[model samples]
Target: MDRLIDAIERTQNPSVVGLDPTEALVPAQVVASFADEVRDSVDTPEEAPAAQLAVAFYEFNRTIIDAVAGIVPAVKPQIAMYEALGPAGIDVYTMTCEYAAEQGLYVLADVKRGDIGSTAAAYAHMLTGVNAGASAEAGSAGAGAHDPWHVDAVTVNPYLGTDGITPFVDAAKTADKDLFVLVRTSNPSSSELQMLDLADGSKVYEHVADLVERWGADTIGEHGYSRVGAVVGATHPQEGRALRERMPRTFFLVPGYGAQGGTAADVRGMFDANGSGAIVNSSRGIIGAWRTSGRYRKDMSADDALALVFDTAREAATAMRDDLRAVL
Candidate 1:
């Protein structure tokens, strides 16, 4: 956790580039490149199209990783997008993660998996190699013994409370991995449940935040960020600030910074005194920037499209840091 925090501080940017590859948003050239291979392999035209889409998606992610690997502290790969494609999809996901790690970029598996006991352990092993298992060994070998998955951390859901989180906690400690527990999400509908008043007058999310802080105490890292971190959405600046105060030592994995109503000002509250402690993630806004109406167009050449996207994302993150610097 300290290493990651140090990396972010050194870069002076908390931006976390999200690898959220969607089939429709991929560059036409990428799709064209795979069309012939897909068409030759599959029987039906429909299957051919699907195969082409998958290939394009993977290539798009690889390009994005290559573009921003050194500019950002981390890359978050949303697992749901990959899982929706099946085994071949998972293969791409694994490869992309390994590739990101090879570039010395921290990979956070944004798999909001939540279950009790052994099932949770399985998820932890899959994401961070926190457990001792054959899959872990295979992963370690595949990433190269020295590479070892290259994942520094993972994001988790805490709806099941301590039981769901304990396995992840144990595994992260054993493997030097880190866990970011979802507390207050950035979604518009999150308040329906998270903001509900408890019997003791505190909101439900408040209790969850307290638990997250306590759980993180045992895993505090040298840079003051904890191996056990919390996910507080950037959409709610006031709430984010309150949560930051409550969990001073916990690293924050903040989503919703782009394509989800969060702006540079909205996320400013996440930083600590030293302008550390938080990583702002932007998914569709970064990876799918080319599809955002007039902002960027799908018809642009892949190189030009990607260059524009990288510049935009880099500028957005730089602006946020600059704003924080002004305030501090």
Candidate 2:
């Protein structure tokens, strides 16, 4: 946790590249490259589109990862996007996670997977390599007994309370992994439940944030960041500040910047006095830049699109870092 936090601080940026691919938002070149392969193998257009999109999506993700690995501290691949496409999609998701790790980038599997007891354990194992299935040299003597295909961390939902979070806690402690539990989300509709005030005057999410702080205490690292963290959307600046104060040692994963109407200023409060406690994520704004009509594509080739997106994202992230530094 300390190393990761140090990296973020040194970079002076918290932007985490998010791989949340949607078929419609993919570039024409990506779609075209795999269309023929999918067309020949599948019987229906719907199936063919998904098949082609999944292939292109993973390749695009690799390209983006290659472009931004050194600039960003982490990459969050949203699981729902891959799961929506089926088994082939899952293969791509696993490959992307492994590839990200190989590139020396921290992978935060944005699964938000939650359950109780045994089922939760299964989810923990799947995300963090606790009971990792197999290694390349699994049967070889002295070939390393434990599989190391684990992610640096994973995002989880805390709706079910402590029981729902114990497995993740165990996984983090046992494997030196990390967890980012959702306290307040960025979506417009999250307020429907999160903002509801209880009879005691505290909001539902306030209660959640309080528990997250306590849960993370046991996992606090030398740098003052806990292995257990919280996901607070950048969209709610005031609420994010409140949550930051409530969970001083908890690392924060802030989503909703860029395309979600959150500017660099919106997330500044989540950081500690040293500017090292949060990671801001932007998905569509960074990955789907090619879809911005013809303006951004005027002089750029498909191969250069990812690079251009990375350049723009890096600039935005840098500006945010500067903004925070000025305040801190």
Candidate 3:
């Protein structure tokens, strides 16, 4: 949490760009260009489309990473996008995280997995890497040196309660990483469950907020936030502000900004008074800016298309930074 705060201070930006490249989001030319390169890499012809798209997604992600290296403190690569393509896509997700870290951007993996017992323990292993022929102790001991995920933090689900989350909290402390438990999400339907009334007459998310605050109570860092953070969607301005006070030691990873219709004003209260407790994320708004830029031509080469992606992403990122700064 302190490290992430330091990064925010260094960049003077609390925004994290989401590297969620989809088939429609990526330039068609770039995906087509990888046909020859990915065909031989796949086991069968049926897998070529996924393999080629995976390669294209990596390239597309790299361009965005390069574009916003200094402008933003972090990049949240949604794993679901990569997981869609199976193993090949997963490789790109890992590679994308590695590349983002190489460029000095904190990587927050969006893997909202939550389970109990051993299953929970195994999922928590994501905080630390597991190397071949190595014991679990030895694996986490390798830390970033042998870690394949290359992420500084990850997003987890809290649907299963304490047992499911405790393992991740312990692992984050041991690995010096962080985790954001889903509290109030930005999705439209999230309200159905998250906003339900508990037996105590409190909202479901409110109770979860209490748990999230409790989870990080002991690990308060120099920045005054704990390694255990909460994911409060930017769309819920009033709720986000209340959570800020309720979870004093808990940092926030806010999503649903930009393309999701979350404005700077909408998320302003999510941050602390001094603007230090939260990092807002924008996905399609940043990475897919090129699509709506109206400057693309189907005849452009792959490199040229990526160059457009870089320029547009950088411009969009700068605008987002300035937008958030204006409010902060």
Candidate 4:
């Protein structure tokens, strides 16, 4: 978490672009090349599509990563997007995570894994590069122990309470990683459960926030923020402000910043007086910039069109950075 904060402070940008690629959303040029490659391979035609599409997905992610690596402090890859393409897609996800790390960006895996303590421990190990059965001696190993697929942080689901979250907290401590527990999500239906009032007069998410604060207490970084952060949607600024007050030491992974009706002004409440403690995310808004902006014209050659796509992505990332900086 401290390392992540350092990167954020150095860049003076708290934005994290999401690398979520779908087959249908991939650029036609890239997909055509990948399909050609699949045709040349010896694998079955049916099996080849997934593998080839995975290549296209990786290409898209790599391009986006290259475009925004220097502008944003981090990139969050939603695992489900990669999972949808099957085993081959997972391979692309791994490649993207490693590539982002190599480009000097914090990679946050949005796994949202929740289960019993033991299963949660496995999830923690899988994301943080810790072996489930490693000895305490092996566990003490430094950052070098992390797996290539490991990320700097991961999002977890807290519905099961401490039983599901503690393993992640412990693993984060051991691996020097971070966890963003889902407190108030960005989806429209999140309120159906997260806003329920308890008999004690506290809301469900508030209690979860309290526990999240406690989980990262001992692991608070020099910036006075805990390794255990909260996922508070930018769409609900009032709830975000209240949660900021309640969890003063917890960093925030704010979603819904764009393409979800969450503007820069709406997310101001998630940050602190110093413009720290939160990293706003924009997924499709950034990745799909070329399609929406008309910068990549059909009249251009395929090579030139692809170049324009990268340029559009870079411009979009820059715009997002400027927007957040303005509000912060």
- TM-score for each predicted model, relative to the true structure: 0.87, 0.86, 0.96, 0.93
Better of 1 and 3 by lDDT: 3
Compose the digit string of candidate 2's lDDT tens values, residues 20-41.
9887666666567676777878
Q: Name the better of 3 and 4 by TM-score.
A: 3
RMSD (Å) of each candidate, 1 decimal: 3.6, 4.2, 1.7, 2.4
- Residues 1-328 of candidate 4 have per-residue lDDT tens digits of 7988999988889999988877656677776677677777635778887788788888888888988888989999998998988887898898899999999999999888998877786677655564335453332323335485758899999888897888888878877889999999999999999999999999999999999999889898889999899999998999998898999999999999888989999889888888988999999888888888866555565466567668888999999999999988
Question: Tens digits of per-residue lDDT for model 3 on 1-328?
Answer: 9889999999999999999889999999999999899878778899999999999999999999999999999999999999999999999999999999999999999999888845777777678776546444532233333677888888989988888888788878888899999999999999999999989999999999999999888899988899999999998999999999899999999999998789999999999889889999999998999989999899999999999999999999999999999999
Q: Cα lDDT of model 3 overall?
A: 0.90
- Model 1: lDDT equals 0.76
Q: Rate the local accuracy (lDDT) of all candidates.
A: 0.76, 0.78, 0.90, 0.84
Model 2 misplaced stretches (Cα beyond 4 Å):
37-46, 130-149, 293-328
**For model 4, what is the C-alpha lDDT against the true structure?**
0.84
Please give the distance, in angstroms, between residue 5's alpha carbon in candidate 3 and its true position after superposition: 0.8
lDDT of 1 by residue, 24-107 (tens): 667676677777787887766766766776777777877777767667778898878877877557777778888888888888
TM-score of 2: 0.86
Give residue 206's lDDT in candidate 2 (0 to 100).
93
Ranking by lDDT: 3, 4, 2, 1
Q: Which candidate is the best by lDDT?
A: 3
